[model samples]
Target chain A: MGSLLQIAVRNVVRNVRRTAITLAALLLGVGVMVSIRGTLNGLQRSMKESMVLAQTGAVQVHKKGYLKNVLSSPLHLDMEVGDALVKRILAVPHVTAVAPRILFGGMVNLGDQTLFMATLALDPKREFEVCPKRRDLFDARAKAFGTSADGMVITVELAKGLGAKLTEPAALLAPDKDGALSGENATILGTMQLTSPGERKIGIVPLPLAQHLLKMEGRATELAIAVDDLENAPLVAAALERALGPEFEVHTWDNVATFFKDILFRQDFLLSLIATVFLVLMLLGVANTMLMSVLDRTREIGTMMALGVRRSRIVTLFLVEAAVIGVFGGCLGGLLGSIVVAWLHVRGIEVTMPTSAVPFVIQPFVDVLYIVKIVCLSGIGALVFAVYPAWRASRLRPVQALAGG
Target chain B: MALVELVGITKSYELGRTVVHALNGVDLQVERGEFTVVMGPSGSGKTTLLNIIGCLDRATAGTFRFDGEELGDRDFNDLAEIRNRKIGFIFQSFNLIPVLNVTENIEFPCLIRGDPKKALRERVRQVAEEVGLGKFLAHKPDELSGGQRQRVAIARALVTQPQVVLADEPTANLDSGTSEQIIDLMLELNAKENVTFLFSTHDPRVMAHARRVVHIADGRLVDGTDSGRAEVAAVAGMGAR
Candidate 1:
């Protein structure tokens, strides 16, 4: 076995030019796999990071009916209790930042087009420090989402449908259970470019204005909690659930940021699909290469057999050769894949989304493990592809082979 | 004891709709330290008989005892061990592995046997020197001439110190001069090492080296003669002069 290994290594090296072609194919497969995995993972990472860093934060702490009903009625408790909860949260090591949010459900109507919208109230002074990009959305949503203390910002699609621009007041209507129409003058302050179909029909205002307009006194719909470790979210949610009881539900960013999560899921599915495709192609390539190598070495193997090398040994030799190719190709693919993935990490891949309705283009942010995945995947693919050719090479008879070749 | 004995050996191969008789009831014996050369036209089963004698192929029906061991298709590994440890083969085209250097090619069978490195290196060196392949140790088969490659094949055949070396049309690919030179080398090796050499050939130069000759036609032995023994003795006389 040891002697066989030595022979296999020398043969591989001596046939460097031929072996290099297989290596190149392997490396190419790895590069594509690594780069793609990295980019998709990076995109997911960025969205998650941005979501946590921004005011929407990690875990969205809300009342039980917050999502299901959305009636602008979140049971508000004492600020002292909220502060104590915040302190309790801060006591846990991984807790990062916490933000309060007020939500009001209403209809935004222009001449005849009326669209149901969520009127979220935010403290822009603190929100900007976390979200960091209010100015960009200021023009798109007009008064819908912005840096000012007065007026409101609406999503671009909502504003356009309403025929409302900057400084134009969009009608805000909230109807009580008794069907009493309550209207408020929401002057345009800024606009937010929505990332999804749901968020696109949104309007934003000052927390105080949103409270007053919705006639909800000193009440917040949810408390958004951010954590230092994204992986620690479930622990944090359980802790929050323990701290807050059945009256409230703690939701992780993965659960609350439905749009972002879906996008990440779609990204994952795409990567998996592409990976499956490349692996199949790589398998075919490796099988083809091994078969060709077997054909090339047939006569040589026959001579070895004639010289007293066993048929079993002949098979083993060919198998060992294919394994050598697989291992080398796999390792090369991994190294090249890792390097490419690392490069992509440092210099990100940018894609711009359509600018009319939705405005934030997708950006990918990658890390290290994605690179490791590509290399391992390539190695596995190569090994899987080597089986048949090795078997064929071992099946040859020395006499006929010598005679034929 | 006879070095090789085959009794009533018959071999048939399936050819689509019929059986082709490659060897039929062949009875022969070759003594130790003898050089036996077989000759026939193509399809006359010369190579098949050589393969059977070398234990590369099993007889379809019959008995063969090489150095007192019965030859039958029993275990593939045992047959391989027999081929590797006791017998060496030389091909007409000098079937040296294309990728192996001359030294490595020579060392192949021993390497397969997993001989110790020091011992293998010494054996490879000695054989290369014996075949005048000392300078071509690093050369691949393609890099060597037809004559040089044949030398490497001869060196490979003897490297393991096998008692019997089988050469099948050993000079088919070489020129007349090269063929004569190769025959002389095999004859010299046979005399010096006292190794039994068996050859399948139609080449006259090859026939010149044989101490015994077996002629086969249509898968049957036509003549077994010793005209070669006298020639071998005459060559030895000239060498003495």
Candidate 2:
């Protein structure tokens, strides 16, 4: 058996050019597989981080019916949690900080321009406990975020649309809890960037001002919680749910960002579809090459057959050759793939939001497990594709083959 | 029973819509140690006869017995095993595996039989020396001359020490000098080791070296004669020089 394998190796090496071509095909398949897998995973990781960093704070707690009818931003669905509940939530083991917030839909009036937008109202000082990065984002002075102050932070795009500047007064009008219309005038403190769909018109205000205008002074829409680690969001959400009980709903970042979740699911589907296409093409190429090899050496096969070589051994010989190609190709592919993935992983891919709808540098992640999967997939695919050709070579009648080619 | 026995053998090939009978109702026997040649014109079923005797192909409708065992109805793999164990083959094209050197090709049959490597190597060296290929054992087929390649094929056939060595038009592609050398090597191996050889050839000069000449035409045996034995004896006398 070892001798037979030696012969198989020699045969494969003897036809260097043809073997190289087959190897190239296999290597190409594996290379593409690794790159695609890395990119998808990296994009998913980046998107999750972006969601957590921007709007959701790892986890959130809201009134029972708030999320179901969240698009309407109904004041009646707001949570009436007291300071006692906030103190209790901060006591949860993994929870690092909590900030109560109110969400409302209203129109902001600036001079003659009026822009309708979804508004988030929160305690500016407590906001720093959950999202410390907002300090750099809003770039506001100390007094602008004062408690009970009538101040707001709007997105850069909204500020440009409103032609408003710092320390300028903007009027906000909305329907309050008793179905009466109310309005308030607030000064714009700063402008910052936000990238999700429909987030261009977002504006932030002090929690008290939002409560006063909406006639829901003692209530909030939700409480955003920041955990010590993002991975512990689900656990923290669970503990908070157990503490807050039936009236409240706790949600991890992944659960709250429905758009991000759908993109991730679609990314998975796209990767599978692409990988399958690459596998089938590689299989066809390897099979075609092997079949051509069998045809080219018909007389030699007959010679071996007449020299008392078993048909099964002939099949094994061809399979071993294919496997050599696969093994070598897989190794080379892995090396090249790892280098390319590492380069992209370090340098990061600059892509528009069209790919995953998140504008940022997506650094592709190359996992060792994904590399292992690529090698196995390529090796197994080569062996499977070689079967038909091997069987055909083994089935050649010694008499007929020798008499002809 | 003869070492090789073919009684009323017939072979047919399917060519699309028609069946062509390549061999028909041929009867012949080759005893141990005989250097037999099947001589006929082209398309005369000489190859078909040799294929059946070598167990490379089966007779469509006849009994083929090797060493008194009937081979007409054995399974494909069993017949392959019998071929590996009991017979060796040489082709006119000097069908040595191109990738393997002379030594590797010579030991190939024993390798197929799963013989121990160390023992097979020693046996291969002995056979390579016997066929005047001792120094060329490291050379590939393409690197050798026509006569040298055929010698390697002969060594490969004899290394197995089978009961019979079958060659199909073994000199068809060789020049006269190389053909004469191949015939002399076979004759020497026969006289010394008593390794039975059954080959097919149309060349009258090759027939002159065979101990027994079995003539076939259109798949039937026309003559089995000992007339070639006189020439064989003369060649054996001059072989020592």
Candidate 3:
């Protein structure tokens, strides 16, 4: 066993140039995935940071049926109940921070100009310690998510579309089931910053005013909690479920983050499918190198056979050489990929948007899981590539092989 | 006692509409300590006969008995075992593994035979010394001269101490001087180890070293002697073409 391993190592070393070429292919493939991972993570960070100014924390807990049937239903009547749940869940072992949230949706009218949008209400006092937005993000979401002195902030895009701004009297009208407009009206006290039009797509209001406007007095929409560590999110989620009991559902950052789960999955699958072609090509490069090696040493192999080297052993030698190339390449690729990803995670990729998406931010990312994923896949890459060449080498006839070229 | 025996061995291949007989009902016996030389023109089945004796080919229509075991229809493992344990082959091109040192190249046969460690090592050491490669055990095949390569191949074959060593045109790839050197080494080794050496060659010098000679043409053994030639032609006519 040991001698075979030694021979396998020697065979790889003998073709140093090809081995280097193969290793480079493996590394480059792994590196691409790693960088993609890092880039995505950074985008998420930018999103969450923007969200903290809007909501705070990774997870949110809302009243039963509030998320699914918010527009028309039995509204959560008490903000106190949500506050209690937030306090109790934050007490859960892995839970780190907690904040409350409220939502309001209505049509805004600037004179005769009217636009429909949703609104969210948050406590700016509590938001400061968790995810305060940077100057650029704050300035943007302010127009879409800003609060007024009357504590009603409107999105910038919504304001422009409605020809309404701070201190403008924008009629907040929503239709009840009777086809009669609720006839609610309020002054646009202030304008919120905009990170995304989607964020501004929601009107901005203080919690008390939002509770009044939504006709659900003293009731909050949800409680947001930050956990001690991001990785412990699942464990913390389960614990919160037990603590909150069957009456209220516990949620995590990943849960709401997955509002785009299907979309993300489709995106991920599309990316991986495209990336696999490169992986296959890289594997082919490895297989091609080994096949060429076998062709060049046909006589040597024949001689080995006459010297009583088993056919299986000869095949194993090539396979082992490929395996060695795979293992080394995998490690190097993973390392190179990981370093590149980690760098991106620390220093994010900047992105620009076309003029149409103005007032909406798009951040690119570095996801650590993506790096881990590529490193793990590199081993399988090497093994699969080496199979054909090794089998070919093993099947050579001793007599014909011994015959010189 | 004979080390190997072949009874009515025949082999053929079909090419388009033609049936080519590589070996045709050939019968022969080789005893221990004999240098048997088989000579033939190309496509005359000399190499095919060597392939059969080396356990590298199966006889299509005959019984081949080696050390009391019938050859043919054995699985690859058994056939490989027979080659490793019963016969050692030296090819015309001095088939030494290019990646291996001369000593490791020689030790390969012993390794395949699964000889005990102490025994395998000692055999490799002794063979290397005997083949005049004691100092070149670390040198790969390409680094050695043509004659040295053949000697290394001879050492590889004899290291396992198999029942017979099959040398199929062992000097075919060597220059005249190198070929002479290789043949002399084989003769000296045969004299010392008493290992039966069956060589298939067209080289006159190789035939000179053989104690007994087997001649073949058109896939049938022929005697070059006038009376024997007449008998072979009469036998060929008595059969088919």
Winner by DockQ: 2
Ranking by DockQ: 2, 1, 3
lDDT of 1 by residue, B114-200 (tens): 887777887788889988988889998889899999999899889888878999998899999998888889888877777778899
Please, what are the lDDT tens digits per residue for candidate 2 over residues A294-387?
9888888888888878889999988887777777787778778888888999999877674223347788878888788778777778889999
Best by lDDT: 2
Per-residue alpha-carbon lDDT of candidate 2 for residues B1-241, written as tens digits (9 for 90 to 100):
6888778899998999999898999878787777888889999999888888888888899888999999888887888888888888888888888888999999888888889989888889988998888898899999999889988988888887889999989999999988998888887788787778889999999866676787888878886453455554454445431
Off by over 4 Å in 2: A63-66, A72-94, A111-116, A132-148, A155-168, A175-182, A190-193, A198-200, A214-219, A238-248, A354-359, B16-18, B224-241
What is the Cα root-mean-square deviation between model 2 and the actual structure? 3.7
Q: Which ten residues in a row have the lowest lDDT in candidate 3 chain B?
A: B232-241
- Fnat, model 1, is 0.73
Index of the highest-TM-score prediction = 2
Residue A329 miss distance in model 3 (angstroms):
2.2
Q: Report how far off residue A297 is in candidate 3 (Å).
A: 3.1
Give lDDT for model 3.
0.68
Model 3, position B116, has a per-residue lDDT of: 64
Ranking by lDDT: 2, 1, 3
TM-score list, all predictions: 0.87, 0.88, 0.86
